[model samples]
Target: MTDTASLGLEDRTARVIAGQRVWDELTPLLASRSCTLLAAIAYVGSHGGELIKLERGSSVIVDASVSAVRAGSTDPSVLAEWIGAGVGVYSLEGLHAKMILAESAGGSRPAFLIIGSANLSGSSAARLTESVILTDSRDCLDEARSELLAWKIRAGKPLTLEEVRALGEHYGADRSPGRKRSEQDDTHDAATPSEELPGSTPEASSASRQRPTQLLLVRLGEEFDPPSEVIYHRDRLSSELGCDDADSDSVLFVFRDQSEPEWRLPLSQGAYVIGVDASASGRVTKQTEVAPPGPVVYLYDDDDGGRYCYLHLTESSRDVTWADVTAAFESLGEKPEFDRNYFRKSAVDALLSLWPEY
Candidate 1:
């Protein structure tokens, strides 16, 4: 019951590739009408400038805003080509009944059409629901495109929070289709609310925002699997949870070899990294009405003897509660105390807990 696809189409940027088990018949199409086809498999975005990503395999539970990667058979090259496309390239690698690709992927940025389902896990996915376009008629592809490039140029790699926001200023809202323009969301001006900004607000800034004791990261394998698998994508995801600061904001750097980013840095210095899974989730689900509700983070040990933590978070704003937090902590078998008042310090402790496994 796996699905995938490769596409070959005329130059126009209007078409749909939606179906089950579609990967087998897919193909990659290069640039056309002055556009380059682009694609990749990664959940990327910024929250107050800290780069937060639910990279692969991990399932993040959040309201659809930024994107929920589509499903299908994915080829690395095709995925890469999708990113190179002229306008906006949204690679819906997994998270729905069908895999999808849309937009010119060149000359403009594209807004995502995320969806929801009955179950977020790969195993329960087959029993999940149908495709639901979370945000159609984005009308911001043009703005997002410019901002995307500025973000790429600033980071010199994949998009980061600062870079993502840098584009926001230029590409804030709706982008007229077929006409590339700048979005004003991420832009800075004398009029922007200063209190909630990353630099001014401790709670709002990625640099100051406190997080839970642990974080989670997930990567979709060839396709979303009823059963997920572990993967080691080192080299691309910097060994040190690669991160940098731009425009005074912090974010995780991206890898050129891979179109996706390598890490999701904490919004604040106090955030921590923790790994979650079905086995672990079961314990937490028992304790609360709302689950952790997003991609699960985990501690990963590459064969090379490096240890780093991952996060399963969204690009746009995300909200959680004390009940969910308490449930996550209660699930640990004999966890240690976190160093700080917030979860930031606990995330480090959580990652250390996995030291032996690596």
Candidate 2:
């Protein structure tokens, strides 16, 4: 056993962390801007980036081998974000170790090394039985640094944006959501041969396969033109749409007018789709006061059925009407009806194309 007192650990240094205790030890180190991080882990599941807050100069190496991507063990989407943020993301075939290295920003303190079974994944952090050894001892740090350096060299060049995008496509295709009756029975007329629908573009197709966006329909008390901003009651959303605050991420909401004909998408107006957080009373509302740069979408209801849809694009986007949208869907053997609020990017793009440009 290592001497914890000498290391100022109070029974800490060279400590073994298991389960959520790993985060209890790790988050403080990451929160310090005075240190930089490098992680060599075999698998990074979807949205795994949320776990490790990587600084600009930080680095990560994962087992992004063909089999890993196909198995959904490595998520290219998170990798793509890391690359875009100028983080050095690399791939090493046959990499199975889970390790992290943290060095003082100015190289003032001895580097710390964390090694063991925990992966940089939600499952590992939240549910899996994981263990790791954390130590700032000089000898262990030196040996681990050397090992990570050797692997980094073997990793060669960091993945380029294009390479990561290609990997994302492959990953998405392999792990495509399994077809279900709920998704198909409402929108799709029938399963026709796989082919691009009329007016479909590669960009549209790619965007559609990405994370699905939810459309929240808020009914207005009176019919009128699009307002500068609209307010929504969080409690009402929970009661009507079963949309809790936690489900508000990536959600785009539109106001429905209390007019005749029941236009699900009444008009195209600018709306903010910011992240939602609960208020003091355990409810979220437009007045909750959140930051900006969140998703902004133009709201519209197809009016074909009592369904609302949201376009992923912003105000300075394309415009179309229900007629244009239905024509495109029908061309591909799909019905114009959008029974549910969750829309794939393809559906959003289709709606964006028909929505009137702001």
lDDT values for all models: 0.27, 0.51
Write out the backbone clash pairs for model 2.
208-346, 265-300, 265-301, 319-354, 319-355, 319-356, 320-354, 320-355, 320-356
lDDT of 1 by residue, 1-358 (tens): 1111122222332344344322212221211112221122232212211111122221221111121211111112222322343223232212122212234343333323222221222212222122322222345344434443443343333322333233333222221123222221112211112222233433333322333333432221112211111234322222222223233222331111112233432221112322222232233332222212122123343344333433322222323333444444565643323212222444444433323221
Give the lDDT of residue 119 in candidate 1: 21
The weakest ten consecutive residues by lDDT in model 1 span: 63-72
Q: What is the clash count of model 2? A: 9
Q: Which residue segments of model 1 deviate by more than 4 Å? A: 1-15, 23-35, 38-40, 43-141, 157-264, 267-358
lDDT of 2 by residue, 1-358 (tens): 2223422455445877777536545655555532277779887776467667775788888977644564466778888888888888889865668888887544444466778877666556654566788787778878888888888888899998888777765453323356432222111111111221111444323332233233322222233244333333323322232224365332334334333433323222112222223343334343432221122222233343222323232222333333454565665577544223323456545444443331
Error of 1 at 62 (Å): 21
What candidate 2 gets wrong by more than 4 Å, as runs, is 1-8, 33-35, 106-110, 172-358
Candidate closest to the true structure, highest TM-score: 2
Among these predictions, the greatest lDDT belongs to 2
